[model samples]
Target chain A: MAVYTEVPDSALSAFLDAYDLGTLLSYKGIAEGVENTNFFLHTTAGNFILTLYEKRVNEADLPFFLNLMEHLARRGLACPQPVRNRQGEALGRLCGRPAVIVSFLDGVSVKVPGVDQCRALGQALAALHAAGRDFGMTRANSLSVSAWRPLFAQAEHQADSVSPGLAARTRADLDLLESAWPTGLPGGVIHADLFTDNVFFIGEDLSGLIDFYFACTDAFAYDLAICLNAWCFSPDGSFHRDRAAALIAGYEAVRPLEAAEVEALPILARGAALRFMLTRLVDWLNVPPGALVQPKDPREYDRRLTFHRQARDARDYGRA
Target chain B: MAVYTEVPDSALSAFLDAYDLGTLLSYKGIAEGVENTNFFLHTTAGNFILTLYEKRVNEADLPFFLNLMEHLARRGLACPQPVRNRQGEALGRLCGRPAVIVSFLDGVSVKVPGVDQCRALGQALAALHAAGRDFGMTRANSLSVSAWRPLFAQAEHQADSVSPGLAARTRADLDLLESAWPTGLPGGVIHADLFTDNVFFIGEDLSGLIDFYFACTDAFAYDLAICLNAWCFSPDGSFHRDRAAALIAGYEAVRPLEAAEVEALPILARGAALRFMLTRLVDWLNVPPGALVQPKDPREYDRRLTFHRQARDARDYGRA
Candidate 1:
């Protein structure tokens, strides 16, 4: 999260007083973000994360974040559980900002996640998506197919800076994505972000997942695409066919993709790539000096967006 | 430019009362961001973009953003010029947020930029870097080499969820990046976020460059890496070798890469890829639900990061 905002430690201690979690032993801000102020807290009770609602975070969405953690935790997802106060409220004021203290999960995010782990993550994600199917809360996919053009518009002038024929290629890709957008696919709650960092594990075992902030009602296959993008790549940016297979197989084992979803994979992947490319591009352009926030390299996403442009079929993902 | 945080049209007019931009004819919010609220404003004076500082934007950096634009514009970089008030202040409070009005650039962003355009963009970016050389600002690269490990640590638990070999590969890549990082590359002010969206063009001639928020003092070669990543790829995610050459040639025409910088290209690219991968992965895991923001696919970045893992020679980039 962005570190420009100051979230005082005293504020977190005050919230802990409500949770009946004993005295807070210590709290330290996790110095790793360009969006929100996050702190790792330890007390007599256990470990937890203290998140102050930073500027990018909306106050009204506090409950959704807190409650979703509770919901996912109840459903056997190994994730951070938002600890409620003695008054049974998960949301509260801290440092004059909305805040919450969530139970800190144990497990390391892997650097090089394995194929078995990929499969397990896939299975777990599918299960999580399934479990979230009936949750009363519903959020729309913000980076849906329709948002692509508007985003590309933001960076259109620099298209010449991107590559030979990139502008035309993107236009073609957009047309392809628009044409093939899924009309009817299995829709459900998806852990939209499922990047390697969000999921935690103990060695090869999938211990739990954290950071469900991006969870929303969307195409289930899109979640798989996010995972494929997150998990199935080699360090050199090449598509690792085996890893992709293992992940897809694992996902299909629990929640198989419908024929329509399969048909939409290419466009979905393209849309997904464009979504990230736009965000990264935006962030790249808008970084504030001295904010301790890093502007992401827009080119990486450019490459990925370009890749999605080439994917013509689900078969491109490799044998299922 | 998410919609919710946008300043109301009436409020925008009220804020403009402090300035002297004449009568407003039309104003519409541009909903294409996870941070900052942008409005396309047209008045008797002409078109302008009104930006309201959002949470992700730090208030303290207002002067830098505004002044940098003014600076670049004064240098004839075809960048947006910050319109100051009658009091000679480029920054002002608007709806409890920092706000500024920048002159609207005339030109269409290329949808299918050709290789020649890519070269032109490269040259323009180099010129921009040179122009900012004496701008008298010093902001360290926030996403510098030091940030990689901590970021990777955030996701190491799920290492097994990726390919078994990925962990070792990444570790090795990190080590390589560490050892190969160029220490003495020429430093200057860089328009770090020179994505196509932030640039403007009128036919074959470049018009203006926008989005100077990420402008900072950094290695000139690093800036080139950013450009390469932005310009050298096909829409289908394939590396266009010819485009890469053209872009490098264009850049070198203005500011040539040092032998050391050339040698460090692979690692720099790797570092660049890793920076986006980490940020995208983090954002992927943490996007708030029901928010107008879109969660980007981390896999796209994962692929790019992987490509950087493969050691490449400057010869691979071709002669300038």
Candidate 2:
């Protein structure tokens, strides 16, 4: 849960005056989005979400994120559509930050998703990749392979502080992955981070995909690899082969993976694990004292990296 | 924003199995309550709040808090009412802590309430006082005048660290207020903490009163005294005489204060300020490292004390 900035009473009143959303009933800062300050809004217009883009989000990228949601939403994806104000603009400024109101989408995000939920997530993700293939924007994945080293450098001195041999081992792994990282895999707009919390479901049915701040044009299989690492692994670091099988099959049902994509799975998964490790390491080490945010353990990715390092083939991931 | 405890997926799913509240769609830890971990839950049934009582809350008082909410809600307070499971029990255990689900209350808490809101808050608080007069359970005001000395002692060592000479002046103020604190002034069930955030408004109407954990048997006038400091003060520390007048008049419209209660207003207000100052001081000085909970500045209460210390009669509060 995160709400880094507070919208004061006068500010909120002024902010709502710009909108046509009936008389303001109530609004609250929701503990949902990590990268933005999100508020659950209830007005005569209906329930909606008011998001204040925080420092972690790039101001220039606001339109890209907004438009992508609009694009996917128009395609019938259940995502938060930016609510336009009287000026017919979806974006506005508040609390010295870029802010916007969006139609509230109702759905619960599952915690430990069941097998059917896993399958539904895979199908939904692959469909999202296909839907965004024609979007009229391009954002390079800033957290991809090319950016890992720089991210690692920021936290290099404190890496061993997290675990012994963590820094050196990560450096060597980075070198190996960088040298062997696949190029020319089929690329498209990928939901690079499809964790359970980002995908909402109404019971067994997928209701929506949210938090597209990490969306970018990347190897389609790389997105799948991120999911393989994110969704198909148990909390203890063991890969759930059956769940992996279900997820892969579900994705293949929507958009079949190329043979080259299959061949690149292990390396992509390893790279995915390391990418998260480096960023989480930097954030874990650099969290300002007394911050409300609790950084995820970089060690989890360490364990995933170990598992991916030993995998021999896609068969080990339940690839058919 | 605070959510000290996280509810795991397994634990949540298991917890919901006991209730018939539709399939879980989503659950998010809310940034509202400070004493407990509160999640805004959306299930097939509808919206509800799931609270995990933290260690800071005494477990034995769970029934009292829940029952008081029930009592007030039964008397038409728009507060959250505890939801019962199939076994007809509203309280259950989750994450090894006392947990319960309550129906969601709609309406927003204003950051800077207007005069109408001040009047609405005053009327609602007095109504709460009458409604909860017969609540079967009784909890002593833990932060009342008698408790201030011990709380001040806990925070005495580091009080100056908060502000220069804050310790000695607070000590002097506490001695005076505690001795002058009036007794036998029409005591009854009181919503001891009626801060703005605990009161909600929809337009000019008061929608709800919440956070009854601090509800206890105390002087009815003490509750009004807390509101005087809470509602009648501006962010810049100046008292709004008109708003205070409106609040007192609104309150007296529902339940007229006895002559003795009116005479005791200044001391009650002073004691109330010190009670909060001491608790907030102890919390501010003793916050655990990296605690998401930020303690309220005791100096704000110091400012309030400064105001109350000079007032010799209720007219200074714009008393009707």
Candidate 3:
């Protein structure tokens, strides 16, 4: 639950004055996202989401996040619509943090996503990639291949404490991914963090996608790989082949993958596991004495890394 | 922002199966309340609040909390109306904790409350006291006069750390309050914890009062005393005379306080200050290492207690 900032009532009142939203009736801090403070707000005008960008979000990237939502939403894609203030600006300041109010999307995220649910997410993701292809602005995926080494360095000394030899395996994986990471296969604004929680559905229909905090310009297939690791893996860390096939097939229906993209899946999947594992490891090691949130176990990704280490091809992930 | 427990997806799905609320469309952990896991739940039926009682709340007294909201709401009290399942039970279990779904109330809480807002809150609190006069079921105010000493005992050894002479002064005040604590004041279920955030408003109209987790059978005037301490204090700990007068007048306009209740106001206010002071001090001294919430500065109440210690009568609180 990502709510690190508290928006005081005075700050909220002054912030809303910049917009045409009627008197604020209710605002609740939503425990979603790991990088921003979100409030489920209801005003006399209507229901909306009030997001305050926190320390992790770059202030300069404000336009990118807001515009992407506006761009996708305007194109009939199911995502939040950024609400502009009376000045026609989507950005504002609240409680000394960058803030934006976006129209609320209507959908619930499935926990243990089924084969059909995975297919819906896959299609929604491909749709998101297509809609963001022409988004005009760009943000480099900060946690991509080149960034893994620095993240690993912070956790390297303590990594083995999480698991014996975990640091060495991670360092070796980072070296290989940096040297051999695929290039030039359909780069665009990808929902790089498309965890199941990021995708929302109303039964079989994918209603919307959220938490675009990690949305950045990266290989579209890398986004697909993240999903295979996030959505297709059972809790016990075993790969679910039918679910993976259904997901990839759903993506192919929207935007078919090139052969190079398919070939890069195994390595990309391993890189994705390593990236999450490194961050989780750092968070686990650095969690302050009284931190409110229990850090996600880095070992969960360690187990996933072990699986990806053995897969040699897209065939292992059941790509048809 | 109090979210103590996380209700998992499987648990939520299973819990909702017991409800007739159309389809579970969305449920996000809402950052509200200090003692329960509250989710802003949206389903095909409508929007509601899902609360899972945590350890701080006694399970045996849940029927009182749930039924009080029901009793108050039935009497036109603007509060969350507890939603009952098909079994006619307004209570259920979620994540192995006692849970209940309550109808959502509209209105936002003010930060720097003024005279008119205080008056509205005062009137509403009085109404709540009157409405709960015959609530049949009674729960003792666990933090009432008799309980403050033990709570103080837990923090007494560490109390001086909060202020130069706080621990010694607190012990002296406790002895005075205990020996002089008045009885024979009109008693009923009082909203013992009527802080600003617990009351919601639309413009100057009090739309609702919420968070009945602290409701209990206590002196009616004592509820007013808590409001005086809560709503009439400035950030620098100075009392706001106009707001205090407005609040008491609003209450008197509804259920007039008897002379004995009025005479007991100073001690009641002092006791209220100590009640909060003791809890905040314990929380301050014992906050777990990574606690998500910063404990309220016990010194805030320490300042209030200093004022109440010298207040001779209700007149000092702007009770004309």
A44: Cα error in model 3, Å: 2.1
For TM-score, candidate 1 versus 3, the one ahead is: 3
Cα displacement (Å) at residue B153, model 3: 2.4
Ranking by lDDT: 3, 2, 1
Off by over 4 Å in 1: A162-166, A234-236, B1-320
Q: Which numbered prediction scores highest in DockQ against the true structure?
A: 2
Predicted model with the maximum lDDT: 3
Model 2: colliding residue pairs: A108-B25, A108-B26
lDDT of 1 by residue, B107-154 (tens): 435544578877888888888877786686577776778887787777
Of 1 and 3, the candidate ranking higher by lDDT: 3
Better of 1 and 3 by DockQ: 3
Per-candidate TM-score against the hidden true structure: 0.49, 0.96, 0.96
Model 3 alpha-carbon miss at residue A131, Å: 1.9
Taking the tens digit of each residue's C-alpha lDDT, what string does model 2 give over B157-180? 888999889889888987787677
Task: Report the lDDT of model 1 for residue B75.
Answer: 80
Lowest lDDT block of 10, candidate 2 chain B: B287-296
Error of 3 at B162 (Å): 2.2
